[model samples]
Target: MRVTITLLAAIFFTAVSYAQVAHNNLFTVGIGAGLIGGLYDGNYPYSSLKQHGNFGLGAPDKLDGELVVFQGRIYQTQHSGKTFPVDDRQLTPFAMVNFFKADKKIAINSALNKEGLLHLLDSVLTNVNGMYAIHISGKFNYIKTRAFPPVKAHDHTPLAAMLPLQHFFEFNNVQGDLIGYRLPSFMDNTNISGYHFHFLAAQKDAGGHIIDVKAENITIEIDVLDSYTVHVPPSRDFEQFDFKKNRAEDIKSVERGDKKQ
Candidate 1:
């Protein structure tokens, strides 16, 4: 009887450990389906992002500006090519956030171009199937980014329709933080399957969705988010939108670059 009790205790402890690790997975505020479905409403407030974790990236309600949270600070960039500090009173329709704890840290030794930098990150990944919240900060030789402006209330304009109105920014030989997420390929149906990154200059005055980057002597920190959580807004447009139709092409175009309508 003593031996049986010991075995049971060991098993119970092991199961609890596993559950705690799994609970560390990523927490999402809303589904990307809302974006693909054209449900742009400011339902989730900026305070919600604060609750999920300290480091993450997201857009404001009505796609007003680009948002990046680092070290518990929220940064916003408007379409006027201006960046500023953000407040919790702001609302968000969609955002991804996590309590950032580094699972691994790697020092990039050589100067890597955009493609090479991406390859380096992929090679060091501890789990190909795990969701990762990534941060890269250091001297960047050059970086290109763009921010989306806010739309009027009840406009109901699809994101694709707002592409032409996006404002682009370019920085050379600057230091900043690259806030990003790496989702599994299986998530392509609801989110951008690969890497999605946002940028904020060290000065906290300029940054946006990362387009291209070049740098060296960088430090990359990655946090393995093993759990997934999503909150849906109670907006009517989101409720009535038909996500059954395929919008992968539209999503890809807006996320990357637009070639066709």
Candidate 2:
């Protein structure tokens, strides 16, 4: 009788542990091959909006528009500075999402620039090496954002070649949210290691990948990730691309948006 009771208890504990682990995993569609290879076509299978979290970020298939998953609804902002609801069935080449339940919240009192703010966030993390899902909501003194249009069908353009084609926008005294991730340095090969963020204006008329930001009196919420999953593309190009070479310079250029439109 005692053996039977212990067996049941062991089974119960194992089931609970598995459930907890499943809840903490972050879901991703596609790898960072696009960053190195510039093969921007979205090849990953389309995942349902219902499967992901209330807040997420991704660009569309073939690198069409910037996607912001706000309040459980997916919105796509194009280079024309227009925002539209994305169909749930739409696919993405790269995306990271989780059920954004904030584990901590911090309020910014001073007007810190983007670099300063990122430093502050880094200081607050208990484990600097751990992954975090970051969401900031409030008023921004000014923000610079950009979105890319889909590449020409006949063009073999890579991301570095497409930066000059992106549309840039600047907003002053705007209210909205920035959604993204902070990954460890070791994860650089698989993702944007430091901080990657996208902006969506509260008015829903403007949004895109964040180039720069200045804000005060904002609430920054963070979800310390316990798990991460990456889905690779099925394309042969991605499989054969040379990720061994360091493309940090190229990525830095894209992030800076140094090319004048």
Candidate 3:
């Protein structure tokens, strides 16, 4: 009997442990953005703006339309530390594109293995008349910092170092809008939120070099999908309605009878 009881207890503990582990892995989707700031020297034209949207994770693969669209814009200015300015007379025209993958591993591995993708990104930058960089690999967290030119004459090492803590930035005369969100129901329990990615683009010189490098203000957004479990608040113990009266109702009846008497 003692041995049987011990075995049953062990089974119960194992089941409870398994349940806790399962509960901790519930998937969630997160969204965020990054902003850039700076002043334009007379030699260049500059305008500040904000980026926003939802980022995806999991089996069905959610959509981060805003990030996908504005990534290049952010990457060029922030990651490369290059200045993107409009012509003195012309407005700074903006363009955006969206990229998607069925899963994070596939996205990272494909970027690593496929030369075409890299070339495609390069082509996009070449046409932009600005500085830009793209790096997709190893669950989106891996940033190829070496791919772009250094932030001109600026000490951005502090911002770069803080990236692991979250995205960081530096510049003068900066301000803008930034926001983010996470929806758990989108991804079907595949633990997809750990990955990260961004593409940045900004105005540059005829030689595709950034000029008068400076960031005014920056807006940053980050979306983490499948990063961890979400806890559902426990249900409340609401009182049930009864058709039949109990003691409280009975007391009311007695009071009515006393009034009638």
Q: Which candidate's lDDT is highest? A: 1
Cα deviation at 17, candidate 3, in Å, is 4.5
Per-candidate local distance difference test:
0.79, 0.78, 0.24
**Which residue pairs come into collision in candidate 1?**
25-225, 25-226, 25-227, 64-150
- In order of appearance, the predictions have TM-scores of 0.88, 0.87, 0.18
Every candidate's CA RMSD = 4.1, 3.1, 25.1
Instruction: Put down candidate 3 lDDT per residue, 1-261, tens digits, no spaces.
Output: 999999999999999986554322322221110001110111111121221111221100111111222322322332333324222242111111112111212121232212443343344333322211122322221222111222332222322232232223232222221111222223212211111233233222111111112222232222222224332212121112121322232222221212122
Which has the greatest TM-score?
1
lDDT of 1 by residue, 13-91 (tens): 9999865654475666767866645666778777767877778887777776678888877888877768887878878
The Cα error of candidate 1 at residue 117, in Å, is 1.3
Which runs of model 1 end up more than 4 angstroms from their true locations? 1-23
C-alpha lDDT (0 to 100) for residue 196 of candidate 1: 87
Look at candidate 1 and tell me the lDDT of residue 151: 74
Over 86-152, each residue of candidate 2 has an lDDT whose tens digit, in order, gives 7767777777778787889998878989988888887887686898989999999999998888864
